[model samples]
Target: MVIRDTHSLQLVWSSRISEDSTFGLRWTHSIHRSLVEEKYRIHDGQIILTEMSFHDYGIGMENELAPGEKLDIQDGQFHIRNMNRHFPALHLFIGQVRAGHTLLFSGTEIPLGSLHAPGAAITIQVEKRSILNEIGGY
Candidate 1:
């Protein structure tokens, strides 16, 4: 997987992700001041949004459920499950330090703010590379 700044078209971060690789993006909701997390997995060479958990609903929050989607409440947190939304590329707005935008992958916490300035547009997507290119470190 790779993350790039959309405006400048500069590579911000890149990592080798295999099939079934899962990651979560977490940030503080600007209005609610609560932590919100969205989990995704790489399946069939695509990015699928698996789950979303948040403390409270605020602006831009999805209230109505779609087909095959389920909502669960536990410990005062709302979890939306079975989304399985496919995206060619995930775009995110890197919020300020107060938002605490972070990426959780492979047991590592990477702060997106450290990679680019606040309010930067970031695009994350999976890229296919041949075995030869991988071996050559391209």
Candidate 2:
């Protein structure tokens, strides 16, 4: 997986992800001031959104569950599961430092704020490259 600056097309971060590799993006809701998280997995070279959880249901939250989707509330948080949504790429706006935009992968936390300035647009996608090509930085 790779993350790039949308406007400049400059690579910000890159990592090798295999099939079934899971990761998550988390940030604070602007209006509700609560935590929101989206979990994803790599499948057949595609990004699949597997689950989403949020602390509040106010503006910007999904109002209703879609077919084959399940909604669960636990510990005061709403979790939507079985989404299985596919995306070629993910575009995100880097929120303010307080929003705490972060990437969770491989049991490590990578704050998006450390990679780009606040309000920057970034694109995350899966890219295929040969081992030699990757090592050569081609």
Candidate 3:
């Protein structure tokens, strides 16, 4: 098998959000580019990226995906909140998850996993602050 050379691109920034735009998370490096790759586990959170993936604006631009583009999940905003019952996932992002008013994360996938898995399983958790803490209440 030919191995692809993925540049060591650190996670410059990261964030999370819900379908209703309830809560979210953002990573700001004290030093620009302080992020690292293969260390996606944040706040003791780790998710295996499924073969799920999709381009931006999956609603209107659903047609953009080619015949074998290989899109596992979606924008995540609508997905994580209200799982696409239509398409169930096998891999998941296990973490402090929530639907709207909690501090938890559904199963999150890495870029690689998100690039392949068809479906995923997510676990939820409780949090004191709204997802707004990570993001600006959006």
Best by TM-score: 2
Q: Which stretches of candidate 3 lie over 4 Å from their true place?
A: 1-21, 29-124, 127-138
Q: lDDT-based ranking, best first?
A: 2, 1, 3
Residues 48-79 of candidate 3 have per-residue lDDT tens digits of: 22122222333322343333334344334212
Candidate 2 local distance difference test against the native? 0.90
Full candidate order by TM-score, most accurate first? 2, 1, 3
The lDDT of each candidate is 0.89, 0.90, 0.26
Give each prediction's root-mean-square deviation over alpha carbons: 2.0, 1.3, 17.1
lDDT of 1 by residue, 17-56 (tens): 9899999999998888899999999988789999999999
Q: Return the TM-score for each candidate structure.
A: 0.90, 0.93, 0.14
Clashing pairs in 1: none
Error of 3 at 54 (Å): 15
Which is the better candidate, 2 or 3, if ranked by TM-score?
Answer: 2
Name model 2 segments beyond 4 Å from true. none
What is residue 86's positional error in candidate 3, in angstroms?
A: 14
Regions of model 1 farther than 4 Å from truth: 130-138
